[model samples]
Target chain A: MEEVERLQHYFQVLSDVNRLRIIKFIDKEKRSVSEIVKNSSMSQPLVSHHLKVLKNSHLVETQREGPFVFYQLTNPKILDILGLFEEMLPKENLVSDFSPMFCCPSWWGNSN
Target chain B: MEEVERLQHYFQVLSDVNRLRIIKFIDKEKRSVSEIVKNSSMSQPLVSHHLKVLKNSHLVETQREGPFVFYQLTNPKILDILGLFEEMLPKENLVSDFSPMFCCPSWWGNSN
Candidate 1:
């Protein structure tokens, strides 16, 4: 693929709130699907779907250990990018509303 | 807007290839709309549209001097994020295709 198309794909992969949540949740340590499901409101299947997208984009990678598989960011620089965004975040967003907008769509049966 | 929503919008703003091209084109120095049009294959209206989106996202800002409006990145850190993406770009993408991808989808009447 061309570089621009690849970048368009990369940014598109990151365009979702849930995907960003998943990326942040697994940023520090690798997490199994069950662990992610247990800690977050996302269902097991939803977590699996986002994980697949992340993997395909080469943003996240998986490791197998026995029967469980753990997922982690492919590069630590991903966090640096996120950190830059955080730094660039306007003060209005930080203070205007502390509550979350929403979790997964109602159809997904998200627990939160 | 919520932080995640704001970020989602920001990423969406960056997801398009033309927007990315425009961002890169204006990265080093601020440029007037006509200058951008003259330098890129994109037309004047399309350049204006992308600049509006970029400005709304706070990724780019504009200045007016007499008859010209100059657009430039709001923060240099935006380039840092792009640099990170470049670093993370796979070797396959860099080496696989040397030809230009279709510019402006052929419908935009791009000169190139």
Candidate 2:
């Protein structure tokens, strides 16, 4: 159950576009907060918050150099998860392509 | 952008514990609403609602047999996503074993 909570929290954090973008910022190389803001539309505070969430999820790691903090991926395997989820998402199965074969408005199994 | 919404919605629904359990029910074989309710502690309406969400995500499909409705997985590929995410979740990386490698509270890259 604890593992379930951890996984759900991980997905919850990744469900945000901003957070995904932050991952992209460092996907190629380690980035300082300043570098991310320079390339991304997110403000400093927002970037900081997103990074904290990402770090807490272990999706990324941070290194401190004097006053500069550099953020890079802690779990590179997360890239595989993100990439696979994107690839498997019901891309073609959007509403336009999806329809029930013969769904019932009610299933009689529930008598209670 | 549309794909992003679809993926996010899919994850959002899956982020729930109940929904995940419903998925488990239908994952192995087709189950009528009553079958799910009979076997699981969930109420009928709750099972139905979760099924609708699953169906909308193309994670499950429905078919009618005479008067009985059967719910089954529409996209078996989703199993891989679930399995992979579970495997990749910071299971070992959980805070019990995780420690900061010298991260700063601030990232200097973001000025704005």
Candidate 3:
């Protein structure tokens, strides 16, 4: 039941575009609130709210270094979820063919 | 971009507990709107609305068998997504240990 709840919560957290963007951004490296705000072009409050949701969902974990809170993907376990999604969802041959969207390095970095 | 849209749409469709329950039901066998409504204890209109959303998302496809429209999981492709999610998410040992939640047979059937 806890696992179900966690999975449900994770899915809910991923449902938002902003949160998904945040996850995508943070996928590269741990980021402070301001950095995420800058990259996502979302309001601080909105980002904070989504971060709270992500935190509660266990999709992300925060570390306070000095005055800044650095947010990072906590559970590498969720990568399995992303992996499953990649396999299950329709694969874009164009993205994979021309670009390296499915490639490990590109997918793991913010270069794409 | 189409693939991303489809994935996002599918995730959005799965976000709802009611929709998830509906999908879980249809996973076993194709079900009519009325049967889904009865099993889920939700209203016909609500079920119809969800089915429409699921259909639009390509998570579930409908077949008009006689007068009754039967809904079934359209893209077995989404199963790969589910598989990736299972790998990424925290594994429930209890569910897998005692019962066979992760097993193919039980997962494909209506039986718990």
Residues B1-112 of candidate 3: C-alpha lDDT, one tens digit per residue: 5434444544665666787778767774879989999998899998988887666555676778788999888766555455455457544332332123444665687432
Stretches of candidate 3 exceeding 4 Å from the true structure: A1-7, A90-112, B1-6, B77-80, B83-87, B90-112
Candidate 3, number of clashes? 8
- How good is the docking of model 2, by CAPRI class? acceptable
Native contacts recovered by model 1: 0.38
Q: Rate the local accuracy (lDDT) of all candidates.
A: 0.74, 0.72, 0.66
For candidate 1, write residues A1-112 as lDDT tens digits: 5676777777777888888888888887989989888878888998888887777666777888888989998876787777677667443432222233556786898431
Q: Per-residue lDDT of B14-93 in model 2, one digit per residue for the tens?
A: 77777777776677688888998887888999888877777766788788888778998777777767777888776555
Predicted model with the maximum TM-score: 2
Can you list the residue pairs that collide in candidate 3?
A77-B88, A80-B84, A80-B88, A81-B85, A81-B88, A84-B81, A84-B84, A88-B81
* Ten contiguous residues minimizing lDDT sum, candidate 3 chain A: A91-100
Sorting all predicted structures by DockQ, with the top scorer first, yields 2, 1, 3
| Candidate 1: tens digits of C-alpha lDDT, residues B1-112 | 6666777767777888898888888887989999999988988998888787776566777888889999888876777677667667543432222234545775788531
TM-score of 1: 0.71
Best by DockQ: 2
Please give each candidate's TM-score.
Answer: 0.71, 0.76, 0.70
